[model samples]
Target: MKAIIAKSNIGGVITTPPSKSYTIRALLAAALASGQSRIFNPLVADDTEAAAEVLTQLGAGIKRQTDCWEVTGGNLAPPSSPHQKLNCRQSAATLRFLAPICAALQGTSCITFAPGLARRPMTPLFDIFQQLGVRSELTENSLNIHGTGGQFKSNEVSLPGNISSQFISGILMATPLASEGLTIHLTTPAESKNYLRMTIDCLQRFGINVEYDDNLEEFRVEHQAYQPTDYIVEGDWSSASYFLGMGALSGPVTVTGLNADSFQADRFMLNCLRRMGAEVIINGDSVTVNSSPLRKTDTGLNEAIDLLPSVACLAGVSAGESVITGLDRARLKESDRVTAVADNLKQMGIKVIEESDRLTITGGTPRGAVIDSFDDHRIAMAFAMLAAICGDTVIEGAECVNKTYPDFWEDFQKVGGKVSINE
Candidate 1:
């Protein structure tokens, strides 16, 4: 879909979508528990739906309610039909978590992927599964795992952490069911450490305990049961970052339903906006970023890599040249966001230099130009915010926001941003 943006200045109060990370984590935890688990404020977006659907296919019962989800889980049965295929649509988390989970279920299962996900990285997790005695028939498009139910050859495994924390999260979720439990040692320093912490936090909410060191290099889990309980997903800092950026570029935009104390990594977005001289007001559970004289500074996105696209938009309109780093891992996301962000910004008459691990965007008012989202949700939303500040612009693949924020277009309009859909 295409989004036509004409009005530059935008402001108003709007609540951001629920956190996709927390929502999926809650769903996976509910699926691992033995009884009914209620999940509140869950984000019912495409990525999360993939997790729910796949978990349901693996024998969990998921009942959707208007306000919450009731899921009965912990009894994973083989599919009634032959060669049950779990289509993990573009959610990397769903694919990673469920693949190891199916292996632990002690049955033969095939996990398939969408076209974009088909090319995602699977190594190390694949090898880790094999080290645990999981036989697999892996191809470019699908993975068929065969393992002895409730059995793992060893109680300890090691894998590099620089690639993704999801691999460790996947194995950790399944270890509770391991006959002897399991210990995981990180072969290298962990990247996206916050995500690992989120996984552990989610596990604790389900009454599962995990032992880990301060550096997060090692974790130990013993045989335990996951206790089902009500879980509430918090608002997403990642999604709110864009609106906050919009407010920083425009003025006085208040985004509600956020926990200021949450450990979500994208909370760094608030700090970054302030560093750029944006006036920020924080109420109990809401944050407002008001427009002010902006200044460019060195921005490190190591901990908040997902904030790259939105932050880069800020860099484009700030006073001086901004050097943004720690985005090398972002290449493996929904799209090649590094190139995509730089390319999209260039279309708007902004000077941007893209590199393997960094981006340098020269600050100036960008002129309106048609931009492409490359079918990435974050890319679409980030550029859409940029379009609001740059004046009349067209964003192709704007519907990609449905991946995480289904009502983004409507919300954009509600916030006083002009948007027209070109059908």
Candidate 2:
């Protein structure tokens, strides 16, 4: 689907969607417990659905309801049929977090991935499996894993922390089910440290404990069991960024249902907008932003790489040049976000300088142009705000937003955005 945008004023109150990261973590944790667990306000999107399907294939019973999901877990077994494979459907989080869990099962397990996920880096996690005496075979689109069946040969493992936080999270979630306690040593400082912290927080909700040092370079997990309980997913700050950017560029927009003290890294979007001289107001769980003349601010996105597309668009209309560093890992996301952002901005008559790990965008009066979303959700949503600022902007592959925020277009319209959808 394509979305055509025209210049217009947008302002209103729209609740943020539930956090996808939290929903997936809660689902996996619930599936690890012995009793049935209830997950409330979960994000019912494609990625979360992929995780739920894989969990069901692994012997967990999941029943979906209108407002919540009931998951009965702790009796996980590989599919009885040899042809039955766990398919992750382009969700890297589901694949990474479930791979290690599958390695702890008794029988052999086969996992398949979509073409896009096949391009992601998985060697680090694969190496850790070898260190733990688990046999794993990897191909372009499929993985064959032979499990230790909860009795890993080795308990100590080491991997780089800079690659993907999901690797660390995968290990942390699975190690608790091992026969012996496990220790993980990080080779480098971890980027996106908040994500790892979020994983530990989710584990604690299920009665699992994780210990780490100040720098977060080392982690220790004791062999334990998960206790089933009701888990509630919080609102996503990542999804709120697009609307907040719109408010800064257009008018007084308010986003509700967010926890101001969330550990989610994207909560820093509020700070970034404030740094750009945008008027921001916080009233308990709701945040309101008023249109202001933005000024360029230099920053690093190492911790919040997902915000690259939205922040880049914000910089495109600011006064001075903005430089965002620590984007080396952003290239490994659903798309080459750094390149996609630069290319889209250039097409909109903005001056942008692109590098391997940084993007320098000079603010100017952006003119509307056709935008290629790279079939990426963040790219499509981020460019939507720019489209509202400069009319006649058509975003190809607008349907990609269903991967995370399924109602993004509807919410865009509710906030008074002038957009037409071409299906």
Give the Cα-based TM-score of candidate 2 against the true structure. 0.99
Model 1 poorest 10 in a row by lDDT: 75-84
Off by over 4 Å in 2: none
Candidate 1 off by > 4 Å: none
List TM-score per model, in order: 0.98, 0.99
Error of 1 at 236 (Å): 0.6
Clashes of each: 1, 0
Over 329-388, each residue of candidate 2 has an lDDT whose tens digit, in order, gives: 899999999999999999999999999999999999989999999999999999999999
Estimate candidate 2's alpha-carbon lDDT, on a 0 to 1 scale.
0.93
- Summarize candidate 1's per-residue lDDT along 50-147 as a digit string, tens digits: 99988888889999999999999888865766567888888998989888888888678888888898767888777888679888888878888885
- Model 1: per-residue Cα lDDT at residue 299: 90
